[model samples]
Target: MDTSRREFLKGTAWMGAVAMAAGCMSRQSAAAGGASGAPMHGFRVAPMKRVRVGFIGVGARGTPAVKRIAQIPGCEVTAISDVNPARLDAVQAWMKERGLPAPKEWSRNGDKDAWKGLCDSDVCDVVYSATPRPLHCPINVYAMAHGKHVLQEVPGAFSLDECWETVEAAEKYRRHCMMLENCTYGEEEMLAFNLIKKGKLGEIVQAEVGYQHDQRSLQYNPRDGVFWRIDRHMKHHGNYYPTHGLVPAGRCLDVNRGDRFEYLVSMETKSASFEAFGQANFPADDWRHNAKMVKGDINTCLLHTAQGKTLSLIHNVCTPRPYDRGNLFMGTKGIYRSYPSLLMAWEEKVGDGGAHKYFDEAKAQKIKEEYRHPFWKVAGEIAKKVGGHGGMDFVMDLRWAYCLQNGLPLDTDVYDLATYSSIVELSERSVNARSSAIDFPDYTRGGWKTAQPFTVDEIDMSKFGFTS
Candidate 1:
């Protein structure tokens, strides 16, 4: 074999060993619960009339999130943090342009941990972070410890230990730590959730979900002579971004509510796409040309729930494909699929006798209108007007603020954050173990059996002085 191929195999073997070691470590600590040995399920705190928001990493995701939060009724952007001073200035200028006061800035001028200052201060009641994946848990744990609730971007924690740390921190500090999983609030996702809730679809038995979109450009594009995302791709070999597809599917199956993920087995195709792309694009001496991307081009993981339901999850970013989450749910009485087109099929007794084929446009529209989530009915127009990922981002931000203002439980809590994000490392262990099954850590500590499933509680915009 050529030198490059031999090195690649060596690296793969090393990663497999590391995954096994991490699994052993995780199992040793799996029994530990929160600091107080209590679960944070259904946990609530006193209402805040106005939730002061502090933003960390005002880059791609954070900038739009800042804009959306600024528009929410009970939210105020009082503090902002970013390593880049230019981005901080941009947000300050934008706030000034809208006749709002400038937020206090936290930049990496002296201390690299400048964002922590925002968490320590009294300027904000909650901290929202859209920073890199690695910083998510540290920021969240620190924010909660400092008496600030935290809302973090997707994949809330990278490892099982971080997941447990988040759970424990939230329980100890008595502060909220919610993962900002916007897809859960998508129009169709919420519709499916409501359908399942209303029994439109009988007991959901299986689901297929995925995050499949070509991200070669984003991963390979040089930013400061560093391929941050691609570098991680070269190092890890698992479903790094599983929550996008898993959260919605898990919710539809009532995961971490009445049912919980028990074990999962994962497999992946060879890592060829990135090397091929680099060979065609970069020079011989460029790091990309010689980098052996360890992460597979396509990864498929099969997860089994405690209640015997199954979920098939796919993750692929290196291929040429249209964006799709593979939001397909199958139940005893009906089925819903949302890709390429929105379609549904119901048994004769459940619907108008179209079990053999998907509903046409008219029937599909009728069913959608009938089972449309209450959230969309109230905030859909304004959400569309604000526009992020077709209004789901706005709805998510609005719901987070609404719950905080009312002292109600968030739609997605610390347990959801931990459970959904845990798939990242769990899948890696399975993949490295040659598709062996890996059991999930019970982050909820047995609270899931009785925890109430998520409900579509409509927000009364008028109560917050909005006429919609």
Candidate 2:
């Protein structure tokens, strides 16, 4: 199973972009969605028949997103593009197995310059952008300007300006732009979000969340190729990856358009390791990668919601601990923690409302019939039956299809992405300036301070005091 020439070239492109030679369009996310030659979201006043999807990266995140999205009812994965030519081999295999058309792939061989143009071709109505963090803004801006909806991977874009440009392009072009923060669809997070929305967590006063999986080994592996994360560590500080942990927590907390997050402070620990173990394990040809990255450690950001609620956010990639998302939410009545037993409270004896009283007789009996995180309420047997990242992945894929089917704004949009990601991009400014409170930019620079929270057919979060 060696890479064919085309595959090798594509892989090289992916590595180049991922390696920072090109700047991140390799590992973030990519997918084929909707149908071909149709309008996505606000393309036209009248609805288009389908949401044709073109995925721009078939590597790690894109592959899975494509695989799962293939299960969507009306979506047609029209095309794919990647720096890693070899990745198409896998895409071809998977598509064949599913009895679908093999999408045309853009590679260096086809035309070194064709990858960017492929995004704007008549073949797709939307582009699922799973490129690296740095490339997000450029690719998204390009796609939106060219009249294509974009579903970018997490953290949306690396810089605040980039975030602004991308979203501005989206609105200007009237294309739907969604930052695919899948963790929000995670069963536990969803359950927590719904519980809070349902008023289960009475008046959330404070919360905690993080992206705390120790990826030290993976991030430095030569076999894993180069990554833009190195650039962040080598040149920056503050919350490294905030969107994954924050989006879900923010959803439950309702930190949106006007319900904004005020300025806060951040503190960091030490760096992981200066030398690349992967480069050390490999040959002199990889010597270019052996260098000291200048990022600080264990990013801990404390935030104060406009409503005076408190939040603790952590982002760490270099640690030797069991995988943990570090989610804990405290309201006037109870609290919720993600790991080490997934639930917490001030003792069930004091239950004013919410999932807290599921233990007490009076409240538990009344709420017995409520709908839980559609997939997570019962993680064992039910999640196993439905499959797909314990069902959150399925939820994400399904919702995209559902939105396309109904012509609605996506569940997670550009504003939500900025709310969560601006923390990382601006935290460095905040920290370097001695924890000076950094003001979040209103990219909507259009009257978004009064914008509405995104909602779906059945999910309404206002009941829990999110109206603030």
lDDT of candidate 1 over 1-468, digit per residue (tens):
544234322344223322332122354444554235457888888878789999988988898888777756567999999887777887887788777788888974735599999999999999999988889999989999999999999899899889878887898889999999999999999988988888867899999999998998788884434466677788998998998878988888888899999999999999988888888888999877776888899999999999999999999999987999989999988889888678898885865565688889899989899888998987776676667888899889888888888888888889899988888898899999999999988877788999988666788654442222
TM-score, predicted candidate 1 vs. hidden true structure: 0.91
Looking at candidate 1, the ten consecutive residues that score lowest on lDDT are 14-23
Estimate, for each residue in 1-468, the C-alpha lDDT of model 2 and write its tens digit.
Answer: 223223322334223322331111111211121112222222322234466788887777788777756544456788888777777788877788667888777873645345577676888888998876777778888888888888888778777667656655665677777888877887667666766766656778888888877776666553347666666777787876787778877777666645667677877766644454445455666643465656665878888877788788887777667777767788766766757545544443454344433254444323433635643432223223334555566567656655665555677666566556678767777777777776666443323355564341342111111112
Candidate 2 stretches with Cα past 4 Å from truth are 1-49, 108-113, 222-224, 272-290, 346-371, 375-388, 445-449, 453-468
| Residue 21 CA displacement from its true place in model 2, Å | 33
CA lDDT of each candidate?
Answer: 0.83, 0.64
**How does residue 222 of candidate 1 score in lDDT?**
47
Q: Pick the candidate with the highest lDDT.
A: 1
Candidate 1 local Cα displacement, residue 451, angstroms: 1.0
lDDT of 2 at 396: 70
Which segments of model 1 are wrong by more than 4 Å?
Answer: 1-34, 108-110, 222-226, 350-353, 465-468
